[model samples]
Target: MANVRQASWDGSPVYELENGTFLASLIPEIGSNAYRLRDKIAGRDVLRTPERPEELRASPGHYGVPLLLPPSRIRGASFPFNGRTYRFEPNTPDGHYIHGFVRMRPWRVVDTSADGDTASVTTEFRTADFPELAPQYPHDLTIRARTELNGASFVQTFSFRNGSDEPAPFGFGLHTWFLLDGEPERWTLKLPVSDIWELNEKLLATGSRLPLGRYEALNEGMNLEGQNMDMAFRIGDRPVEAVLSKPGYAIRYSANEPVTQWVVYTKGEARDTICIEPLTWTPDAPNLDAGPELTGMRAIAPGEELIVRTTLSIERE
Candidate 1:
C-alpha cells in the first residue's frame, strides 16, 4: 500500500489516501474538508466536487463534505440561550445565518499517518482564534476533525470541546454531496426514517413533524427519476443508514446516535448529485423553544466535549 501523499489543489494543500481500490482526498485549508472519495475500480466518485477547483475555493459550500456547526439555518441569525441573546451576521442574503462559519475558514493540521492498510489525517480549529466570531457564538470551542480511509470505507469524526467556563449549546453535522456513475433516473435510494420536519415558506422548520406519506418510498428502494425533495427527517437511537445505488455500484452512509436529524436534497436543477446531511439538530433549532432532547442540541458543560462519527462504505455489484 502507498502512504498518504500531499498535493496542491489550486495552490491549497490537500492530502490523498490511495489503495488498490479507493482514493480519498482531504483539504485542511478549507475547514479540513474531504472533497473527494473515489472508487478507482468502479471509476466513479462517491463524493462529489465542484466542476472547477477555484469554484470550491471561492465557495466551499458548493462542493465537498463541509462541516456545519449549529448546522443549517438559524432564523434571523439570532437565538436566545440561557437568558441571553446571541446574534450572528447572516451568511445568506435572505437574512439567515446559514451554515456555520468554520467551513470557509482554515484549520491546522494536527496529525497525519498512513500504513499498509490505512491512511488518516486530523485537523483542529479553535474558535478563540477567530475573535470576530466571538460575540455571536460566545463560547470558546475547539473543533477537532479526522478523516480516515481504510479498505473501501471512509470515516469522518468530529470532536467539539467547550473551552469556556460556562455551558454552551452545540450541534454539528456534515454536508456531503454524492455523485453516481449514471443519470439520476438510474439511481435508487433507501433511507430509514419515519417522520419529517414540516418547513415554512422560508424553508425553516415549523416545529411540527409529519408522517412520510408518499415519501415513504424511501423506506424501501425508490427510483430517483422525477423525484424532487428537500426535507429533514427525525432519527431514533439506532444507527441510521442511507443507501444510494446505481446499476453496478452502491454507496452506504451510516451515522450513529446524537445525529438525530437527516436532511436530504435532490432538486431537479442539481439532479447530477444528491446531498445527505446527517445533523445533530433541525434547522433553526436554537430559535425553536423545543427542549434540548427534542431539538438535538447538547449543552456541553465547561471542559466537556461532544463527538459524532459517520462512515461511508462503497460496494460494487
Candidate 2:
C-alpha cells in the first residue's frame, strides 16, 4: 500500500499521496493556504506566511486560492440566472460582504500524492446557504480542485458539475495571488488587451470600455511603493503577460486563453502582494446574459460536465 501522510498546514489536515502532489488543505485552518513551490536558491519569499488559513493563501499579502461564489461571498440576484441568493452565514466580519463562496465550508481530501506535490480536493455547496433566495434557486453541484506541481509552476484544474435535474447556477475560479515588493501602482502592466472595462461600485460589470492608454504596458509593474490598486482589464484572445520588477526581484507570468481578464488587486502594505487571478470567464459570467444573473448560464444536462483547464507559468529574473 502507498503511504498516505496526513499533516496540517493550518488546522486542516493536509493529505499527501504516493507522489509529490498535495491533494487538499481544508480552509480557515491549515488548508486555506495555497501550495508552496519555491526556487529555494534564490532566497525568494514563495512561502508567503507561516500562519494557517491566511498563510495558505497565494501570499501573506493576497487572498490566495479563493474558491469564489459557492462559499466565501454570494452575489445577490440579477439576470443571467434568477432566484433568492444565500448569505455565507456572515463568513467574515470585516465590514462589507464578500462575493459568492470562496472559503466558508470545510473541504474534503478525495485523493493525494505521497511526496505532497499533487492532489485533488472536492467541495460541495447548496443553494440553501443563500437562505433568502433558496426556494427559487434550487440546484445541486460539485466543485473539484485538482492541483499539480510541474517543475516550477503550479497548475490547478477546476471541474464543476451540475449534478441534478435543474441546471445548477454558479460561477467558479481559482484565486492565485502573488507577493509584490512595492506598491502595485508603481508597476507597469503588459497584457494582450486593447481596452479596459469600468465596474460599478458594487463590483459588477458596467459593459463600458476604457482605452488601455499608454502602451502594451500600463500602470502595472511600475514599482509604485505607496499606492494600491484593484482593477480588472479586458484582454484579447491571446495569452496575457504580467511583468513585475523591483530592485531585488523581477517576475513574469503567462497563461493561455479563457483567462483573458486579469483581476489585479493589491494593498499598500500588510505584506505587499498582488492577486492575478486566471478566470475562464468574467467575474460574473452568468450575470452578463439575460434573465437572472444566472441566465445564459450553461447547464450540465444532469450527467454532463463542465471542464475548465488553465495553466500558469512564472519565472524570476
Q: Provide TM-scores for the models.
A: 0.95, 0.69
Local accuracy of candidate 2 as per-residue lDDT tens digits, 1-317: 22345676545555443323222233423233444434444655432334455444433223445655431122343333335442333323443334444354445555555343333333344444444535444555665666555444455666766666765655444555566543445444444555665667766555565676643455343444443556556665444666555544555565554345666565444246766655444554454532321121344556567665555444545
Taken over the whole model, the C-alpha lDDT of each candidate is 0.83, 0.48
lDDT of 1 by residue, 36-133 (tens): 88778877777777665677778787677998887898899988887889898887788988888888899998998888778888899999999998
Runs in model 1 deviating more than 4 A are: none
- For lDDT, the strongest prediction is 1
Q: How far is candidate 1 from the true structure (C-alpha RMSD, Å)?
A: 1.5
Q: What lDDT is obtained when candidate 1 is compared to the true structure?
A: 0.83
Worst 10 residues of 2 by lDDT: 17-26
